[model samples]
Target: MDAEQAHGPGGPRWWRGRGTPWRSTLLLTVFVFVGSAFAARMQQGERAELDLFARVLLLVACALLLWRRRYPVAVVFGTAVAVALYLGAGYPYGPVFLTVAVACFSAVVAGHRRAAWTALGLLCAVHLLVAYWLYRWLPPSGDAPASLGQELVVAGWVVAIVALAELARSRREQWARERAERAQAARRRADEERLRIARELHDVLAHSLSVINVQAGVGLALLDADPEQARTALTTIKSASKEALGEVRQVLDSLRTPGDAPRTPAPGLDRLPELVEQAARAGLTVEVAGEPPRLSPGTDLAAFRIVQEALTNVVRHSGSRHARVRIDEERGTLRLRIDDDGPATGADAGGGGNGLAGMRERAAALGGTIEAGPRADGGFRVLAVLPVKATAEGGEDQ
Candidate 1:
């Protein structure tokens, strides 16, 4: 993973080897070599007597730009100071100062607003002073602009170039702001997704484990007292185990991103019968009514989970000996209804009913709906209805 991208979103899938030390070193070497070449090509026909000190300073400042992102303010100020001394040497300058201007712009874009302004101030001040001093020393040589008006034109040209560079700086800062906002939005979405997944895990695992725990205790107690009853207990354990595994698989599926590999097919609408069977094995008189058809993969999975969670709740919470699972497909939708004649008293009051909220959340995610409350008919009922497809599949019609 690239060090520059390791801390970024989705965990480094976009780190395409772009942040290596070798690449940075190579780029800096190229910049310094180009600055030296431009320095050597000064003056027309006459061998420009290059000041050794100025040439070395220009090379150092040009090479220093590689660290601009890491130390923008230092590089900007350092380059400005070096360029001043180079200009004061009274020799024709080169393209090295352009590199400093570029670095200043990057600093501005990196959220260092105050530092960027400070560097900009020092840059304009130092360059203006250098121009004035250079003009005084040799206002106009034979090859220089012939008139005061022409000299003023050359001065204007320099100012125009600086203005263009500052414009570039502003653009970089704008781009940086946009990138920051995008990152913040991504982080917020990730946090929300994590919370949702956590809620699902809590609901499914807590409810399933509570039923299994109670059934296991019953099996152990009857093991010595009645062999036939113990056999029934073992059967209940097997059914509960299957139901728990299925719910767990669904939660894992929900946590995965699209195109990722957790492609284990979830038990959908067809699995409602299996859930009712598990309740039967747990010694509850289980009954099923109506019929819900083949739904889309998402709807099917959510519907199955709702029934399974409801059955688990009945096995754990319903004090009565009977529970009914009612399912029906109507008007392009499927509704799952689970009710138990369980008295909300004693152990049943604070019973293992953690999966109810999770089931509701699952239904909501599918663009469906769920409602779980005490039925007016004196039983606990959970009703969930889901569309064949999500609202996101076909957004609101304008």
Candidate 2:
């Protein structure tokens, strides 16, 4: 398993790296002393009492548990073998089996299923053999052999330990999977936020820069011929620049504090008149046909951007001074059309520049469609049809 999956969230670095913690060492020390003392005490008033060798073996089995996480299978096998040897040597039963049982549990929790089962089988077989040895060698009384009850109890205890370990392992794996999924979701949200910011920045800067470029050129050309006209052009540039700066700052502020109320509402269909007046100042005479209908916020913003981009293209690329805009709702669709009397050129054509692509993206996002091309009568035209409500094929209403 990978480190992230093995350790899960909030796991310590030492545990994640498969290194033993100081607590394990402390536990090993405590178990060693306790098990050795227990084995020595079980030999009270017995002719075959535990000797120094039996105590040392029990201590060694307990100490082996400190490395269980790093070498689960080996530790389990080694501890089991030590316990078997101590028992075979006729040592009295003691807490040494406690260390072996813990080793079995660690093996399963560490994902060593085969080793755990093998250790369990070995332990059961050793218990049966020890029971038979006690029956044959120890003096038996009228009471049914006590070894039988002890063996049954130890078997049940081993099964319970294995079951609990498996349960814990399953829960840890599930928690890891959930953590990974949440991390992926957070990344997706961050990417979507970045895309939204890019679209807003492009729309604001592209339209404002195009207008300033046109007005600056006009002012330069009329500088000597008509000084008054040149001053008027300069004044228009200043006004447009200031307005663009304020809008740009507002957009940035919205991003900086998304939870705060916006400084100004987003521009929508209601702001078309101001957009038309600005285009007129840029020397384009735009004629309007139909009144805009009430629209949802998303649809309103998309409609306004489509109109602004279309008019900006007309002023920059279409050499015509006159343009027509028509807005009408028919059959649950809002149809927007803009036509100019300028010849279509390669630089202003749709599908080849950011402006038209941005407009198309806006339209498509709103479950709408856009078409822009040269008209048969020697000018350019852009037509867009947006749904009043989101379409089934377009996902949500926004």
lDDT of 2 by residue, 321-362 (tens): 899999999988999999998875445322236878878887
- Each prediction's TM-score versus the true structure: 0.65, 0.76
lDDT of 1 by residue, 172-260 (tens): 54565688899998998788678666765665565556556767778899889988887877776677677678767876786667777
RMSD of each: 6.9, 5.0
Model 2: residues with Cα > 4 Å off, grouped in runs:
1-14, 17-19, 24-50, 69-77, 83-155, 330-333, 348-352, 364-398
After aligning candidate 1 to the native by TM-score, how far in Å is the CA of 153 from where it should be? 8.4
- lDDT of each model, Cα atoms only? 0.63, 0.75
* Model 1: number of backbone collisions: 0
Error of 1 at 257 (Å): 13
